[model samples]
Target: MDLFLSAAFGFPTVLFTPMLIVVLGYWIFVIVGAADTEMLDSVDTGGDAAGLSAVLSKAGLGRVPVTVALTMLICVAWFVSMMGSIVTSLIETVSTPMLWALGAVVLLIALVAAWAVTSGVVMGFQRFLPKRRGDSKHELVGRTCLIRIGEAHEDFGQAEITTAGGAAISIPVRTTGGEVLSVGSTALIFDHDAADDHFLVTAFDPALDPGQH
Candidate 1:
């Protein structure tokens, strides 16, 4: 028990311990319905998350949700580091500095091994996961959505739309002609802005909906 605690709190393994805790907490929240599994699905192009996403994509781990990939990565890293630390503790003759150096080496190996293992697992299960349909973007056009953010204007907005599968998804939206689309207001997705990766919307009246008649 002492050795297990020591390894978990020791140098290299300690680096990943907090991450593992966070991953565990996130999953707990997911299981309780307090968080969404796809909460981190969207990556801001200019942020650090985007860089990490690019790296994961290059490593073939991008097909899965970022949350899933990161959870697997941290779990694998923590386990490997813990094992390495346990093995290092068995070497009694090593000086403090030498042990630190060895821990650093273990950390590096753990990271690489985690990525490799995650990539292989992701590839093996990719076919079983729901594939994102490219045509869905075009299909969203002409759909009615509810504004989910503050007032939507030419520059910024967000809305929620339900798909044929009954899953609600939030999407980036933009308005033209200075329309007043506020939270809870209905909007029509008239067109898709492929260049900006958002939907072009206009204010909608629920009474005007043909289905209401």
Candidate 2:
């Protein structure tokens, strides 16, 4: 127990200990709904996080959420560093300077190993994760949807549409010419506003549907 504690709190392992603690705390907050998994996703576009994002992208770890990638990285690095520290601690008659040098090498190796392992793990799991893409957005342009919100106006609205795959999803909607669509009302999605990422909708009349004729 004493040796484990000494190795954990010692150099190299010490560098990743704080990061591991932070990752654990953040996950606890996420489990309690106090934080979101995507909270750090937008941080990759700008600020200091951009540099980190670039590095992860280069490492093929960009497909996963920043928090997830970071958590895996810190966890793997901490474990590797802890093991390295324990191994080095077992070495007797090593001068203080030599131990420090060995710790530095361990830190570097830990980082590389973490990246390699995390990248493989991410690739293996990424296929099972839901993909965020607009490939099907165009298919919804001419579909009819039921208004899910109380009212859909020119500025704001939401409606539920079923895809060809039988999956239902809620999408932002808008009306033109001061059209008002209320809940339980059916609306036709005639166009998609790419700039605002919303669908243009108007009230639907079942009798007017060409498919019925």
Candidate 3:
């Protein structure tokens, strides 16, 4: 064991002790947290929780939250090594040149490990995040819809439609005064009501075309 340690790190066993401890602790924390989030996606929660995930979603971490956390942990490790009396005691008494080289090597390894762990976690979770919801303003134009609820007469109503491929759609409905629709009535989609975020619809009947008798 001693010969292997010396050959690998070019240092005595004692010198490699701290590096192994820090690396082990870092891997345990990051891997366990990642596994926990992966399990949570299976159960439906009211969307309330706080932890590493909350940190990832803040305007800053869109692509990789784990990477941010790993970077932070590595920085903390370096600061602790430099400032903590115990860490200073362990490495400071050693030869200055050897200590400096070891510190540089350890810090580099920590950074690379952090980056790899972060990239893996982010790639794994990207697929599980819920996709953006709700129809866009442009898509509501010219599509047929049904009155789901509410009246459409110089006022407001709710409706649902399906795209030609059967994907469900939702839109708000309204009509000129004195017009109203009940459940299951078909309406022509015409315009969008920006103020209410609803769709303006007109009664559409296929039998009564302008060119037909």
Q: What tens digits encode model 1's per-residue C-alpha lDDT throughout 16-81?
A: 999999999999999999988766654341212244555677788878777899999999999999
Worst 10 residues of 1 by lDDT: 42-51
lDDT of 2 by residue, 86-204 (tens): 99998885598999998999999999999989999989998997753222667677778889978999988989875442345678999999989988898999988888788899999
lDDT of 3 at 71: 50
Lowest-lDDT window of 10 residues in candidate 3? Answer: 40-49
**Of candidates 2 and 1, the better by lDDT:** 1
Q: Using lDDT, give the best candidate's number.
A: 1
> Worst ten-residue run, lDDT, model 2?
42-51
Candidate 2 differs from the real structure by a C-alpha RMSD in angstroms, to one decimal, of 8.8
Query: Which scores higher on TM-score, 1 or 3?
Result: 1
Q: What global local distance difference test value does model 1 have? A: 0.82
Maximum-TM-score candidate? 1
lDDT of each: 0.82, 0.81, 0.52
lDDT of 3 by residue, 179-208 (tens): 877767878778876777667788887455
- Screening candidate 3 with a backbone cut-off below 3 angstroms (N, C-alpha, C), the clashing residue pairs are 172-199
TM-score per candidate, in order? 0.71, 0.60, 0.34
The lDDT of model 3 is 0.52
lDDT of residue 94 for candidate 1: 52
